[model samples]
Target: MKLTLERSALLTGLSHVQSVVERRNTIPILSNVLMGADGGRLTLVATDLDIEVSESVDASVDAPGQVTAPAHTLYDIVRKLPDGAQVQLTINDDDRLDIDAGPAHFTLPLLPSGDFPKMTADGFTHDFTLPASELSRLIDKTRFAISTEETRYYLNGIYLHSKDGLLRAVATDGHRLALAEQTLPAGSDGMPGVIIPRKTIAELRKLIDGTNADVSVAVSESKIRFTTGTVVLTSKLIDGTFPDYERVIPRTNTKELVLDNKVFASAVDRVQTISAEKSRSVKLSLTDSNLALSVNNPESGQAREDLPVNYDDEALEIGFNAKYLLDVAGQIEGQDATFMLESASSPALVTDSDDDQALFVLMPLRV
Candidate 1:
């Protein structure tokens, strides 16, 4: 392959596909990016067996062919090259990729592109389009709670489903859960519930421009595809059933405490400094309209702070992971974050005072 690409254009394509390349790979081609140049365009593809990200950019195609090269190394070289420099890439006779830009030159070992695995995406049952910002809201609101434990593979991704004319996403990690809902457009009425893997959620989130562009989505039983402009993401769905997250959402919590979102988050952040490294526990003591936040660690020290809230309910005390509380508070869009508590042992439900589309549930920790 022989082609020349504007530095910005080449960098754009490489940036979109880098996350799909795993840093450690057992297979050779899986670690390299496949580059194809033809018809005045260059396409870059990176895959980690389960997920694949591809981007095509306009370029000067001297000769139409394909080659595979180290994704990160090539990206780093282009990143360091001077601005506006034209990048020339060619496949050498010795099966290496020659990169030349400005005064710097580097050769990366080339692997056969045919060996790169592609996810099978056939028989798409539902196809629809969502505004970029809306899709981003759905993913961002819930991704923080996605389980990182490999033993519970089913909980490692967000559950996406269409219900009651809304597209809902729910993610949970046993300790905390986040649920977000967005209006569903036409043709997405009968979409099946699918578990989008953690890596795909992250890659797709990166593609969202949060602008006027609309993202095209196609969902099949085994795979899901998201395309925005020249970038495409294909991922295999986790073949497992997501737990009934709705059951975990409490409906009978009557106690309410409303406080400034930023104040609560800041207080949590400050008090957690003295929390134990192992538990990271923070105690919440609610009395009348005053809320006290405190953390004690034998090895470290003790931290305490107080903030007046809108609560007038029965005085209650609860314990929670200081970091998890901050994460939930950070997602609140409005000025006030309201928490509905049932008791000291039960989970506390959190929601923005004005935003009804997002909700969070936090299980209390024993201090």
Candidate 2:
């Protein structure tokens, strides 16, 4: 392929696709990016077998063709080039890829384009459009709770489904759970629940970051595709089934405690300084209208902080992981955070006072 484009345009396209390419590969072709120049555009594609990201940019096509070249090496070269410099790429007779820009030239080994694997997405049962803001909110609120434990592969990503006329995203790691919802878009009725893998969720998140354009999503039993503008991302869905997360959400807890989210998170952070590094436990003692946060570690020291709250329930004391508590608190956009507690052993339900669509549940620790 022979094409000329601005350094910025090429860099943008490379940055989007190169991230999916792994640093080490067993298959030689998998290490290269497929580049095609035709119809006044240059398309870049990179994949790691499970996920693929591609984008097209305007280019001056002198000779229309296709070739495969090292993804990381090509990206680095184009990224360090002077701004506004014109980048020219061509395929040599010896089956090598040539790069030229502003007095610098490099030759990279080329591989056959036919060897690149593409994730086939044939039977998409559901398709929908979601506003960029809503998509971002759904992901940002729940991703932190996604499980990193590979053994429970089903919990390693976000669970997306439609229920009660709301499009919801749920994630959990057994210790903490996060759920966020938005009004169901028009085309998402009767969509089957799907588990989006953690890597795919991260790539989709980065693709939609800082953009106001709507995202076009297509879902199948085994694959999902997302398109925004000229960029398209295709990923294989997790084959394992996600557990029923709704069963874990509290329903009968009536002990209501409302307090400033920032204040509570700060207190947890401060008291946890004297907590054991292994458990990082923080204790919350609640009375009629007061709350006390304390931590004790024989190896370190003891710390406590008192704050005023709006609680009228019977006295209760619970211990929770300080980091998990802070994580849930950070997701609360409202000024006040509401906690529904039943007993010291039962899980505590947390919610944002201003956002009824989001919910959080935290399993208490024995401190």
lDDT of 2 by residue, 1-367 (tens): 6889999999999999999999999998889999999999999999999999999999999999988899999999998899999999988889898899989999999999988887787899899998778899999999999999999999999999999999999999999999999999988888888899999999989989999999999988888899999899999888888888889899999999999999999989999998998889999999999999999888888999999999999999999999999999999999999999999999999999889999999999998
TM-score of each: 0.96, 0.98
| Residue runs of model 2 more than 4 Å from their true location after superposition | none
lDDT (tens digit, per residue) of candidate 1 on 1-367 = 8999899999989999987888888887888888999999999999988888999999999899987888888888888888999999988889888899978899889878887676677899999998898899889899999999999999999999998889999999999999999888888898999999998999898888556699999999889999999999999999999999989899999999999999999999999998987788999999999999999888888889999999999989899998899889878999999899999899899999778999999999997
What are the RMSD figures for all models against the true structure? Answer: 1.4, 1.0
- The superposed Cα distance between candidate 2 and the true structure at residue 159, in angstroms, equals 0.6
User: Native-vs-model 1 lDDT?
Assistant: 0.91
Pick by TM-score: which candidate is best? 2
Candidate 2 vs. true structure, TM-score = 0.98
Give the backbone clash total of model 2. Answer: 0
Q: What is the lDDT of residue 327 in candidate 1?
A: 89
Clashing pairs in 1: none
